[model samples]
Target chain A: MNTKELVEQIYKKKSFLCIGLDVDLNKVPKHLLKLDDPIFEFNKAIIDATQHLAVAYKPNIAFYEAYGIKGWKSLEKTITYLNTNYPEVFTIADAKRGDIGNTSTMYAKAFFEDLQFDSITVAPYMGKDSVEPFLSFEDKHTILLALTSNQGAFDFQTKKIEGKELYKNVIEISKSYHNAQNLMYVVGATKAEYLSEIRGIIPDSFLLVPGVGAQGGNLQEVCKYGINDQVGLLINSSRGIIYASDAEDYAQAAANKALELQKQMEEILLFKK
Target chain B: MNTKELVEQIYKKKSFLCIGLDVDLNKVPKHLLKLDDPIFEFNKAIIDATQHLAVAYKPNIAFYEAYGIKGWKSLEKTITYLNTNYPEVFTIADAKRGDIGNTSTMYAKAFFEDLQFDSITVAPYMGKDSVEPFLSFEDKHTILLALTSNQGAFDFQTKKIEGKELYKNVIEISKSYHNAQNLMYVVGATKAEYLSEIRGIIPDSFLLVPGVGAQGGNLQEVCKYGINDQVGLLINSSRGIIYASDAEDYAQAAANKALELQKQMEEILLFKK
Candidate 1:
């Protein structure tokens, strides 16, 4: 899906929420383990429960990869299900993958062509050549890691390079890449205060903001600075929503948690209008 | 495997030559495609042919991931083959993965525990928390990307951060991480000049050097500055070695190419002694 369709979905749903499918079997309900594919089942239930409240689903690839071939199978099933069931919801492969030019092209094909995710998160450490391969795919967005939500973001990202923060330099430099209109960014919600400066650099580009409830990032503060005319912010909540309750009503409980955040997003959108 | 074991293997083989198994189907022999698992069969042939000459094997994860589940199955079978047969050879998963603390742990588990690689390359843009999890794994090495072989390395890696280059800062900061002894660094052969300054920070840490032949890096030039008492470098050659020929004699051709590099590495080690 392109930026226009994503924005349309956000407006239609009254929520720019992106549910994170960072599924860990240890954290899921005990009953689900009896199923043939517990991970896919858990994700199917959660996606069904909260599809209305979310415009996107960002599946953390690490969670699936940890399970090996079985994990890859589950991931394939999950992506297939999403595309077949709810093609309108934007899908993000939270695979922070980047490499040398040719190698990166292989990765781009893996996520964008084979798995069929609308977008895949990419690490910017390897710089232009590492990232441009993903950008070459038309209509497929490459969400570059700008200022991450984690504590480690301060280690190198916030460090000054040529008298400016490295993340800002990343944002500024990435804009000049080939077919850069397909670029989006991963800006951590934990650093909401930095959104204004980030917005100054790429005001129109979409920012997939993770780290809300469980990570102590306030939704109001994130929306206060992050919202654009098109509402170019995907506030992601993983543990806070999906792991709300591990009982049989776990899906409903997840929906309830999502409802709370969606209501806040709805109010914010209404107020902005 | 521990650092001691890796160094021992390097000396025993008299070659720190790391064969890169970046098997692209397009480049492989036409006959291999007729096999049920061409990728695995290709890797098995290359490993069997070149196992005596090379001390390490680095499988580029992107190549495997590109094929989806079948690719992952090939990867699993290839790794299993290596571990079961050539148990003495060191393995490196050229995944270049990193994320937040918890997510990084999952990735570490995927590569180190599930995949059972002796070492895995990780990007350092996320800094301490992203990398320390990989370090925590006993005997498993975390090769952090310092100066990559690609042209994009000049984009941000060479930029001055706090008066020192970003790669140097990465080396310096990473040393303070927990279980820093398990940390190795990825210093591309293209930037052999940067190896001296990098050696100044972590002399004992192994450097996984790619870009030897196909990318125009010299073994002797790299050895001059990068070599330590243990001959701390794993010189990787992917296309130059593995894709040497695409005929029925592909395995023998690959072995011949690997033998040339192994001979060069032997000369470097002798000269150093």
Candidate 2:
């Protein structure tokens, strides 16, 4: 989906929430094991439960890839399910993938063409050519990692580069690339305070914020600095919602958790008005 | 394979060449398309013909992943073929992957456990936690990108941070990780001059040097600054070797190309002797 459509979905749903589909086999309910593809079955239930409450659904590709061929098939099934059932909802392959120009084109084709995700998260370490291939796809978003929520973010991302933070430099420099308008940034919600400075760098660009629910990021604080006029934020919650309950009522429990977030988002939007 | 075993293989073959199996369907011989799995068939031919000339096989994962499910199946077949028929060869999955701690563990499982590759290339942007998980796997190698061969490497990699180049800092900091012994660095052959300084940081660690022929890197220069006591370098040549011809004699041509590199490397090792 394009930025305009993404923003439209947020306003229409009264939430900029993006549910993360990071399924782990050990954590899943025992009954799911009976199915031929438990991962897809689990994802289908969660997506169905939370579709109305979320504007986006991001399946972390690493989770599916761990299972090998079966895992890849599960991923295909999940993406197919999302596109077929909820055409209006945005999809992001939370696959932090990047390589050289030609190789990256192949990756762009894999995620954007074959698997058919509206967007995929990319690492900025490989620079412009690695990322530009994904951005070149018209209307498709290439979410670049900027100030991630992990402790490792401090290892190099937040370090000083000519007096400015490395991530700040990344955000500033990336804006000059060709088709820069199609670019979005992944700023972890755990560093909500950094969002204000990040906003100063790219005020108009959408940010896919992941760390709110399970990672101890406060929603109010993230919204305080992250939300733009277009509600330019996709707050993602994975384990907190999907694994809320592993019982038979797991889907209902997930819906309840999503509904709670949606209600808070509605209040946040109303307050902005 | 362990460092000892890898060194043994290099000496046993009198070559440390790692042939990259970056198969492109359009570039392959037309006759191969008539096969059931053209990509795998092409790779099998390349491996069978060139296995005696090279000590390692590095399949650039993006090439296969680009083809989606069928592509992944081809990857599985190629790896299985290599492991079954040529057990002595070291396999490197040139998939530059990295994510959060938990996510990276899944990737480690994917490449090391499921795919059973001896090594997999990982991008260092995410820092300690993202990489440590990969390093945690016993007897498996995590080849971290220190300085890439691409033009985009200058964008951020060569930039200074606190008076030290970012790539240099990456090499320095990563050495302090939990299982740093299992770590090897990827130093592009184009930057052969940097190898002396890189070698200074991790004297014993093996470096996977790409960009030899197709990218205009001088093999002699790379060997001059890169070779350690164990002859610590796995020089990769992809297009120059694999795409040597488009005729039915493509496999034989590929073997000839690999033989050329192997002879050059043999000369380099003989000089060391």
Q: Identify the CAPRI category of the predicted complex in candidate 1.
A: high
Model 1: number of backbone collisions: 0
Colliding pairs, model 2:
none
DockQ of 1: 0.91
Q: Model 1, range B76-146, lDDT digits (tens) per residue? A: 99999999999999999999999999999999999999989999999999989999999999989999999
**TM accuracy, model 1:** 0.99
TM-score of each: 0.99, 0.99
Interface RMSD over true interface Cα atoms for each candidate? 0.6, 0.7
DockQ of 2: 0.87
What digit string (tens of lDDT, one per residue) describes model 2 on residues B224-246? 99899999999999999999999
TM-score of 2: 0.99
CAPRI band for model 2: high
DockQ per model, Cα? 0.91, 0.87
